[model samples]
Target: MMNVLSAQDKQRWRQDGYLVLPGFFEQAATEEMLGRARQLLDEFDVEGHPLTTFKTEADGEHVGDDYFIGSNDKIRYFLEPSSLSKPAPGAPSKLLVPPAQSINKIGHALAQLDPVFRKYTLENEKVANVAKDLGYHQSPRVLQSMIICKQPRIGGVVPSHNDSTFLYTDPPSAVGCWIALEECTPQNGCLSFLPGSHKTARVSSRFVKDPSGRGTTFESVAGVEPNEEKWDELDGWVEAACPAGTLVLIHGNVMHRSPPNPSDKSRLIYTFHMIEGAEGYTYDEKNWLQPTKDMPFPALF
Candidate 1:
């Protein structure tokens, strides 16, 4: 098969732990994805769980464990405070009507649930080539698909985090393909990644299911010390200002984050995470999410 990423693209990803593939997908394809994403939001009557660290300020209470463990083959919504309108003046102030746009993200796992996503992920030759080029000589396990709409004006800041901390595999294989469906700008919000931080930084902790299965918790590693000055120490971040149809490859351990969106416009993107799924590699048992017996992670190669 032909390589999806050119030699130069691979080199860029190697040197920086990330790479930007500008205009990767066609404009029509991105438009179709954006349209499908919006349509999915209209299908669900229920709002989603804001699963961010800053979710205390979100509209709903903390997300229940069932959402993470049981939503393998379903489409759900996650809200950003910006999506919903504030209570009307002089009214009860308790019931906030669904604002102009009231869904911040569409999922934590999507390809396994939706046909459109599944078709593109499993059948698209181009996508498979990218997976092959990423050193996954065997089939790649493609999971954790989401359409994140950084809503205008009130999108919260996403703190820097490592992908492997959440999706840790035995050999530590986790890579994220963040695709911009709409223009991602510094004015709205775009990802900023620290160059070459993955080599030295360690996974300090992991978000996992509690032993008793009551709720989710972060289990900290015994000896790993938090590196507060790491981002500053490594040449700082490179903001990914990409237009629609662009793809950004993010390393599993690279430190990355995005600021709150303060602009009137919105930044919409679709993201998928892949990990080595071949034998000899095991998914961490303690990780907060797992495939229910009915739905399992799919293959792409």
Candidate 2:
């Protein structure tokens, strides 16, 4: 059973940019979560759903009004790029298949909106202890959470990138906790990591939205350039296959990627980002997702 991070484990995380906790959550819990996930997916009403699907212009940022702009706090479905149609000029984005099989992820925020996830991430004190042991020191904030549905056959390649790039802080404090609900294996596109990358990896650009919240884009921050090619040349990237109920703690700046799942099995996983909630460190306003004023990302203490 997984417990608090030992000193050796902490050292490994500090030096290697990650630590894997096998069976951190009990098997029964994982099974329950998986069941709930499927139940929610089946229960989601999709009849002429206005925002049931979302997409970015090929190689472009997300574009929309309040209905889309405000998706940050709401539970919603985001479509994978492989499932949407490429429009020419004035045509609406078309769905290539049934909406259920095409979803990339379920959320901008599911932890606060859903009780099953809330129990695992927020109500569990052991997890809070894990976060403290990982060096958050104080109460860590559950900044963002998602149920990544690496849908069978069409799960798009998650490009080589870092968590800090997306959930950047002023001093760059972002930690990712990824849990595999299903068996994550090579055939299903398990996450690949560049070992010891946090020692030198830097936050290059961040996904952001305009102040008016019209369009989402990437803005560069003060950091190092992309060195994926160099890292690959040195054979640094390693595939991390996680079993069900395993928790993988990932540093903010470690370069990682997962290949597209071309297999018949879906690589379903639940993940969330935690950031240092202490003074002086600030989450950039430019970061696209923001919680509602009434229901801000909670403190995990």
Candidate 3:
């Protein structure tokens, strides 16, 4: 299988701070993923458990908005695990994997069955190569998952922000892989990004209201103030729309957000994050970032 990114692609990533690998997964893989998701939902329902939960108020005041089924509680949880399964000792403590075989199957399948999917992760060649190119020797770390299931009337917008601010890391080196499980279009609240924002220095953190108004606004970490008119400056900024199985890779420092799903159908997406190594970083019990590393990449990958 092809394992390396083309020089042109690398250059584009360097220049734009993001890259879109359209149709990275085949129809077969996409269908399989959907099947797995359906099975998980059924299992959760059979057990009288919720298959989807809210990751943020942006998901709206419904059970399905920003729905995430299976094991990933850090993203959202659908069911509680049975006694047959249990969480790992000192596992990230995010409740990402519920203690159930059916739910665990989803996580396991995601980690093993899909190479193209796996390649976007921190351990993947592209990430490692990027880290090395940037003078880091360690591989990036998987931060969290952002799963979305947009509702029709209630679908809410995710405001612009940088992911780096939420994560606590030094020399901030992280990226996000957003995989569309269903067709996404402007009508369905597709994601939009500001190109080259990641290459800029980190900006001050701020708080903004979540579109759904479920509660307090999500704390935004890495976006410039509106007065900066950052979006107007990026000629390459594009609204991302793609069919199922498309993957959008973005820098952690990049500014991005999505609008409400105004369409009749739901829009499903899964986003994951990776960072280069675990050293020189500190986190509180809440897993929020605290200061640690003071220097940039010191070693080559």
The number of residue pairs in model 1 that clash at the backbone is: 1
Error of 3 at 58 (Å): 9.1
Q: How should the candidates be ordered by lDDT, best one leading? A: 2, 1, 3
Give the alpha carbon lDDT tens digit for every residue of 1-301 in model 3.
Answer: 3334667867877777777777776788677655555554444432433343333332123222233312222223332222123448854223333333223122312332344444444335554554444332255545454344554534566666676655534555666667788898999888888877776636454222234543223343444443355554557658888889887777777878777765777676666666666667533322232222442222212
Model 1 compared with the native: what TM-score?
0.86
lDDT of 3 at 188: 81
Q: For residues 1-301, could you state the per-residue lDDT of candidate 1 as single tens digits?
A: 8868878877778878888888888888888888887777667564244332224221123344665455556666656654444566855222133432566677766777777776566777887888788673376787778888777777777767778877777667889888898899888989898888888778776666778876566677667776666464466688989999998988988888888889998888888888888888888778766766676777776
| Candidate 3 Cα misplacement greater than 4 A, ranges | 44-137, 201-203, 206-236, 281-301
TM-score of each: 0.86, 0.89, 0.61
On lDDT, the stronger of 2 and 3 is 2
93-126: candidate 2 lDDT, tens digit per residue: 7778677777777876778888999889898877
Clash number for model 3? Answer: 8
All candidates: CA RMSD (Å): 4.1, 2.9, 10.4
Cα error, candidate 1, residue 179 (Å)? 0.9
Q: Which predicted model would earn the best TM-score?
A: 2
